[model samples]
Target chain A: MTPAEDYELPAGPGRNDNWQGVTPRQAFMRGMAVALTVPGIILFASAAGYGALARDAGFSLGNSVFMMGVFFALPAQVVLLDQIARGGSLMAGTLAVTLTGMRLLPMSVLLMPLLKGKRATRWRYLVAGHFIAVTAWMEGWRRLPLVPSELRMDHFIGIGTGLVLATLAGTWAGFELAGSVPHVVEAVLLLLTPIYFLLSLIASASGEADRLAIVLGGFLGPPLYVAFPGFDLLLAGIIGGSIARFVVRSRGTG
Target chain B: MTSSLHEVTQAAGAASGTLPTGLTLALILTVISLATHEPWRWLGLILGRNIDVDSELFRWVRAVSTALVAALVTRLVVFPAGALGGVPLLVRVLAMLCGLGVYLLFGRRISFGVVTAAVVLVAGQSIMGP
Candidate 1:
């Protein structure tokens, strides 16, 4: 097994034991380096796409770029923009976008333990949670175990900073280009966001359960859309996840 | 219809032709939405003994979050926006599937999956029109 595959550290050290080896600063810098490479490009492209979509939907360059800085979550931003375009009530749009962001809560909770030091305070978690996007989460999952516990936070900060800066710059660039670009270019640009997502999913899938979840999710998600239309995402996710859990459980028992 | 267009232009000019106020409001809402997750994180800290954010509980959360994000992306692709909005949904879905299939068949390389999917999409769109 590879180094990533061989190690499987629990979220927290047993008792209050601090991790050894790397310092937070070094790890953070390493993470930043990684972010600047493959992940940075992806984030830039995705954010640019968001800018283009926001422009196409008739949002201002300033507002679109501003949202990228503040919200940071793309899916919720997309939902919010789409709802507003449809003349949906501000309250309704807010609620929908917020609901879409509900997933972040758990994600933050899960990542906190990995990066938190034995003596770490609540405030640290609160701040770090802001950087908890899919890219960071996956990187943390893979790299946190390898680094000395003390340095995980630094690694995360390094990566998170790179990602945030890249996203911010990309969003602004896309917004500026929105008006001048043709519609087809915008469509393809927007399409790149999802394409990046699909590719990332392939990269992150580990173990039978994860594989099962993706396969089930992929097969079931599209069909559910055909049947339930707008509600397919929620329904298909619930069904796929439950099935994957059940299969994993059965296999364990057997 | 002509009069309505004129009215829209007037409104657009008055608003500095910027994004609609409702969208700005929505943007504000998105910013503050970060608070919603606070309560849950705190709750986990308080009651869930040994439940650090990195605990199994959070791992499940991360997994679910990953899936949800994936689902949203898939939704956008399957039910696109603006110009490609007119492209047949099946074609988009097929392109994604083809890309995914190629990725899986090639040992699940991220670059391959993304590039192949993107190529398939552009190629399919060009050949099929729209």
Candidate 2:
């Protein structure tokens, strides 16, 4: 076997639950099935909320659909929609979206190494990287250790595709239902995005760094938004994350 | 002449649509992913995987990602935009706490927590009448 393939194999005895004998088709199916679970549901709800908000902000249904398919990230899409609705210039909107997307940088860096096995070509990695949003990143982080390296990319792509399709459908549905839906129901739908994150933050935390960052960021986010409304998310994340990392490192846990 | 000029400017402003902005934002999101993700993966490939995965730099990268997402989530909760902002501050915080309580109590199943929070918000608004 090639060195890369050997490296891709899981160390020691493999878990019976790991995708040892699974084919690529099975891996993709596994990914798609995961989308029906909590992670996929949260993404769908958020995208639907984005769609409703976009429609309310005067975007055409097509535009709302396009945003979900293209931008994909809800926070960035929210910024873009809000800015456009408020009559901001294109340059300002673009900058805001780009800043929100900066969060993806770390996600990309983390997922890149995990996805690269013997079968990964340069193009394959790049394409797979497109699918590495919060849900994909967290799921991959949790699941990649168990997957055969050859199936990692396939599994990721399947989940990513499922996530994309879910978001798109949710957006379209929200756009359609925006006005007709009751205010309370609408409120519930819209609130799901934040609630999902909060719960995920508390539940998905796996390490000291994660817990510290979440606490620091949650504490700092409000004040920072009031102080620097435009760049608040970016500022809070960088500052809070840096502090958490430093603390972890100093304590020898990093 | 001044009245005519004002009318023309108003019409021009109304005619400007969000098409350009949507396309531009989409392009920017795509580019950000490509620029940030592609370079690192390629570098890892060239230099060998051990250095890339085991290094201190990658750890910091992950730490920052978690922080950013957490911060953004908090921002949405504390300083929500659009319709969510209409709910009173107390109500928002209480609802969030309710959801969080459920999340912790129920083994962190995200849907259960989110549902609890949403239910609280809707129920609170109904009882409180806003």
Q: What does TM-score give for chain A of every model?
A: 0.69, 0.75
Those runs of model 1 whose alpha carbons end farther than 4 Å from true positions after fitting are: A1-29, A88-102, A118-121, A182-184, A201-254, B1-27, B30-32, B37-49, B52-71, B86-91
**i-RMSD per candidate, Å:** 6.1, 6.9
What stretches of model 2 exceed 4 Å from their correct place?
A1-23, A79-121, A141-152, A203-206, A246-253, B1-65
Model 2, range A22-84, lDDT digits (tens) per residue?
Answer: 888888888777678767887888788777767656667777787676656676676566555
Go through the candidates in order and give each one's DockQ.
Answer: 0.24, 0.29
Residue lDDT tens for model 1, A146-188: 6666677777777777788888889888877655677556556
In candidate 1 chain A, what residue range of length 10 has the lowest lDDT sum? A1-10
> Going through the candidates in order, what is chain B's TM-score?
0.57, 0.66
- CAPRI class assigned to model 2: acceptable
| C-alpha lDDT (0 to 100) for residue A171 of candidate 1 | 86
How high is each candidate's TM-score? 0.70, 0.74
